[model samples]
Target: MSTLGVNTGWRARAACRDHDPELFFPTAHSGPARAAQAAAAKRVCAGCPVREACLRFALAHLPHGVAGGLDEDERRAVRRRGAVGRPVARPGPRVLARRARAGGCSAAQVAMWLGVSTRTVHRWTAGGAA
Candidate 1:
């Protein structure tokens, strides 16, 4: 794990996973005990930047798994929500083509300047974003 930036490497993002705080609250507990864990989960999630990702992963893999400090049951409640109609849309062909042909360098040159692999550059040129 590179200790250069606060949010650069996979190790930084995976710090929580390494600690495995989810193991502290097992599902074999009673009703009241479960409630206590849920409450604790909310407190932990209050400071987690990756809370959404955690919640989504938990909900999608329900009956087991934890996210945002919450276990499976808690995660499900978060997922039973309606969309806010944020108007999401993907980039079109022309936009990709334009990105592929920046200045006179092309996607290959741009990828090299950026210090990425050639296959990545080819993907950009082929209109397949990284």
Candidate 2:
């Protein structure tokens, strides 16, 4: 038994009516028309009850597809600014080594602490002073 007969209605539509590419894809003008469509998509997402869920599902499953009214750029930005309460990681070894050396830890000692080669430590020291 397929659920294709179910009447999902406009409420379940992912994109806004105004921004629906179905309307614009055929007759859209040049840049201006595309911009208008993007704006419309964002507006629909702004007040959508299922916005987050829609976005999450889109990103998790169809990472290449736009959903919840967001295009690729908007969805990427949303994912980049995620606020799920986890702390951000600091910069990598070169940055850490420079900071440590600046704070007076010798290159070898910093290497020992960080478990990296002394050549790496020297490279960081050289890069930082540049």
Candidate 2 lDDT over residue span 28-119, tens digit each: 44343443444344455666776555555555444543455556554566568883233323346577567667766677776765678999
Model 1, C-alpha of 46: deviation from truth (Å): 2.0
lDDT of 1 by residue, 16-88 (tens): 5545577435564644345444434444554577655544444555455445555665445555553212221
lDDT of 2: 0.54
Number of the top candidate by lDDT?
A: 2
lDDT, candidates in the order shown: 0.47, 0.54
Ten-residue segment with the worst summed lDDT in candidate 2?
1-10
Task: Report the alpha-carbon TM-score of model 2 versus the true structure.
Answer: 0.36
16: Cα error in model 1, Å: 2.8
TM-score of each: 0.39, 0.36
Q: Per model, state how many residue pairs clash.
A: 0, 0
